[model samples]
Target: MSDDDGLMLNFAIPDNGTTTTANTQSKNVKVRGGRWKDRRILKLELEGRPKEKKVKGPNSIPIDASRKRRMEEKPSKPKSSQSNPTSEFKRAKFTETKGEHGGKNDSYVSSLFTNNTASTQEVPEESKEETKTYLPSNAPDKNATSFAGLGINEKLSKHLTDHQRFKYPTKIQKLVIPNLLVTERDLFVKAQTGSGKTMAFILPIFHKLMMEYKHKIGRESGLFAIILTPTRELANQIYSVLENLNRCYPFLVPGIVIGGEKKKSEKARLRKGVNILVATPGRLADHLENTKTLDISQLRYLVLDEGDKLVELGFEETISKITKIIDDNSKIDETKDKWQGLPTRRINILCSATLQNNVKQLGNIILNNPEMISVDREVEGTILFDDDTTGEVQTNNEHESFAPDQLIQSVLIVPPKLRLVTLDASLVNIANKIEQSGESSRSIVFFSCSDSVNYHFDVFTRDGKKFKKVKDEETGETKTILVSPDDSADEDQDDAELTSPIINKNTIIYKLHGSLSQQTRTTILQQFIKDDPKFPHKVLFCTDVASRGLDLPNISNVIEYDAPFTIDDHLHRIGRSARVGAKGNATLFLLPGLEEGYIDAKLKIVHPREENLRVTKYETILSSAFGEKNSTTKNKFDKLGNWDIHATTWHLEVERWLLENSSALAKASHAFTSHIRAYATHLSQERNFFNVKLLHLGHLAKSFGLRETPKNLGKKSSKNNDKFEELENGGKKYKKEDPRKKMLRLAKLAVNSTSEYNY
Candidate 1:
């Protein structure tokens, strides 16, 4: 064997010109130079030792030839049914299934869930089918070609098709019109929003009156119908619809009596006589008790439009009183014999989009042997559902409230500091889209209070000015800010190119709220609904005044700048769009952190039939609004820096504008204060998600372009000092009111001052 098979040792020693001899017992050893000539050897003394070898263990043993051959010859077996317990549980907990619409059925637990059972419940097999309840729809009937098919007279049908361009009736109209015309039973109709519920009842009343005109049905034929609405705006809209339908028979006069109108004028009109009257609950109740000329004995139909809204607005007591008074005054039943087609007794119809408990109570108060008509819903007969086991009343939670499927609902979780800048960017993006498509777009941004609306409207329409930067002298950080009209003489200056107003010149902004005069409210609403081709992009900044019953066409987008106080309000805010089968978009702005939890806790299951809610990235919106500026370097941080830079610059300009304009600053401060007060008024159940105490005061102030701290904005108004007279002024001296009592008084005032238009 070669000497390499044996272990060998080597050591080094200092070179001293001495010869060394090698003596070994085995012949396998070899020796070389001993003066450390070979540097690779260790420079230490060592006793020669052999290397130890490791013994083979079980894991290191090679497989037997027979077993290897058998394994290679046979195919591998499938995995067994049993799996690790923890892994099986994980798979069971998070197994996602594809819905019919291609959305994933998220089975993961929500972080907002407080119930332990709900969070840790065992998931059922997705393959097993579960019963699903569908909400109501407003889809038009393809088979019913014309209004005549739904029992409308020939004249009215022709006018509808040729004049109004209403060729086909919706599903609600098809069901409701025939029932009203054929039978005298009262109706409680529940249908989707924007589903022509107005025409559903209007046509039947019109057709009956027109058919009986030869029998002396004229404008002087006594008040035949009384339509009660919750708001003046809706009452006005109903009157307009009635006018459009009256073209077939111009002699059938319809008049409106609502608040914000002169009672003298209404009384004069009532004396002149009107066959049909449309009025709000409060105004109508007043006319019923005060005005004797307003006759209701010959009333054939008492229709309650938006019955749920009326009840929600605390009009139930007024409605009940009106109905009782009318009942006590019904002495002309003999006159109904002459009107052959009309109902022998006054017919009561309650209409609403959803059937809540309050609406059901209102229906019970109005309807007599009513037919509950809910098209496209699975339930039959009546909407008064009862639990089978407990015999307790139950509202259909599945169809409690919902948005149209065509409405694209999305949400953006932006930090409070970025809300104002993001809002500007979003508007710019929408305007750009309208310009690109060459289509007119109407957008509405809803705020919490009128002050907020006022402040924001001023910010946008400040003479169409843009913000610019200048150098600061105190900080010496090269920071300067100024504002001027975009078309100013300084257009050629370098500052002009820095930042322009987010709103376009073609944009028209309108503000409407309860504080405005009635005439102003009517004028603005009329102008808003009227199409203006000159301004393709129209934005209305208002509170909840415009949320219900008013049908403004071509409303392409809705932005909820402030979260609604309740889920019902949220539904109504978004219901402004995607009406009558038209496509639209709704965006909700939510602050980061707890506000984000509102999505899964409340909004996730709002619509039972489909999942349309999506979370949009704020950065993408920012990019679309403010186009990317030219940069030398491109990276993640660089992109973030660009967004931050643009937002800072725009906000700086707004701050500077506020500094110069004292009036605007005052409005901003009031708005900031009112917003906090309103934020506390959210419903108790939803308070956990929108707690006012959790807000970052400084950051929220930034959104309103207010640099002052929250404490300064929240100071009590000094104007109230006039109420407390001094002893020297010859009036009784008064002590300062306790702060707690003052706060309680203000809170009560806030609650009591809430109007239907604002709240």
Candidate 2:
């Protein structure tokens, strides 16, 4: 994550986690000296397109001209597949650095197999006791399970296990592999992040090609499979997985094409021919119109990894263009009777961690009767599931981030100005704790945009990257906000003592993100994978690219250096750590001050609103964890907060109503607790400012505005509001009436009076 203008931000920590938006109130609050907006952080990019390029003249040769010539010469190339427009981030063309390694184009390199890729090649046979329609990827006795049971190539099965220790098929892999291998089914899988969806589609499709077509597959069919990913990082991730699996069959040529690198090497690679190609949609589209040697007329497999993100990021047109060619060509291939006895069929598979409407729409256009597979959020199942029934329950809502039971999650609220300092302290605490226990720990720190990513990276590594100078508009005084405190502490700096231990002889930090050149990114990942011979990487600073599909080893902690834009993002970030049944820790950095995190971006310093009920929401997150059943949980908010609202009696009335009702709602599903925690965090992040006069005038009401449940809305309340004295911050303490107690009592009462329950 380096500072650039691609994946960007305009910060305001809203009631929900989102970036690049804020309430444009008329009044501008003053900060330090200038208006808040002037002093606010300006984020350009998070991943790639780190900086805006100088505008080139319209007459100048276009950056993608090399690819454009192929489409012009080739009559068979589809017109719509040619994307002349620039990609998001408005990426300018990049050239290969001098002395860069130009890998061989004609032969497959041994890049996939690491030193220990086959550390344990021999595996025991799978158990016959398991005969479920679906299977868990990892089991308690994973050694007892095998992919061979699912009719996989025994050699392929053995390699997969050794490559990544994928002992058994993940829920996605278990169901998806067979469908792709045996049938003509299209798939739209909505599994939890890190559930092995990449392997599910890759293993089956690649295996089929190696068995049937081999190296000549591309020569005859011209790009047998086209895997489209949203980002270059993801393309590389898919490429790595596919390339390693390609080791099981050397004849299968797998390659990747992305932006931010010279097109010559990729073109040469494609010219020599590639059977399976993983590419970012924009770059692939660029090639479809330009590279004459590259052809997708016989493309059979089209997989959209992170389909939701691709659609959300506005890649619909590009995807459709690629799909259109595949669609048109598949019909031609069928008409020619090429697949009389072969398993080759144009298959469309879309996989996303979060299932949203756009993703479904994308699938509808590309896939025919595509099946979905969602992993359980609370627990990974060990038994079989029905083909029609995916076990998608309300409790397993995708809005909540999924962490394995082994991951220990916690949060620390820090003032914005102190973020860098606080990060140091937290790291020291974690390292010291681990050192005392005589254990090694690996961690990844994620940021919202590349600017933040690069800033933190510079600070952590003590790199001399220039820290931007910010001026106080009123005073005209400037200072570097993110300079490494140890390396270049400002003369007037106050927090001189704050510093995180950068690295010792035992530690190494690695950086990975899309903004870097493709070559550098690849080198960083490969070195990270091998843990570098000299400086073994223990910590990685990156953006969300590392969050998806790329499973690095020995990751003990995932740190959200910046609050993620959505709950899914939060899940994916942490998902990088506690992967495949390993213990890890995650810490979310929250900035509640004007000088710090997202809150600082807003124009005004607003106080907390509805202070009383905020307690219950947080307590819900804690208490619900101990409860086994949603209906039986008796947790309350009394122990949650002080429940002290210094307001008129009318405000107390509202608080009472909320407390009495929210408890029951919280118990309706397990996800409610997570929702409550997220809600509370949002409240803390927002500038809390509600009119006390409105409450005194009886203008305040429960279940008002764009709220969720009003408990039998359109009907009158079952119990009337009671009369009470307006005690300052405590209308009625009511004898040990802690929020938790109230929750337990209400839960029991609601369960007993089933007729009165609105849920």
Best by lDDT: 1
**lDDT per residue as tens, model 2, 1-759:** 215534333344223234322343223332242334333422222211234344322223233544555546877633341231101111122222222221123221111101111111111222456422222222223543468776678888889778757777766566667777877667766666666778888888776765663233544455778888877667777888887887777777888888777889889989988888988888888888888888777677788888877875678898889777556655435533554433456777787876555665676557765555555443332212123355222222333223444555555443322234445545544554555566666778875444344544544553223234689899899964545544454645322112233534445566665556566677666656564333333667776667766677778778886666455566677777656655566777653322133322321111111110011111122222211233334332232222111111212232233334554233322222211222222223332421111111111111111012323222211232111211322666345455433433333333233221010
Q: All candidates' lDDT scores?
A: 0.70, 0.51
RMSD (CA, Å), each prediction? 19.7, 29.8
TM-score of each: 0.72, 0.53
User: Which residue runs of candidate 1 sit more than 4 Å off their true CA positions?
Assistant: 1-137, 376-379, 383-399, 465-501, 609-611, 629-641, 712-745, 756-759
**Model 1 over residues 591-610: C-alpha lDDT tens digits?**
86777778878887665445
Best prediction by TM-score: 1
- CA displacement after TM-score superposition, residue 262 of candidate 2 (Å): 1.5
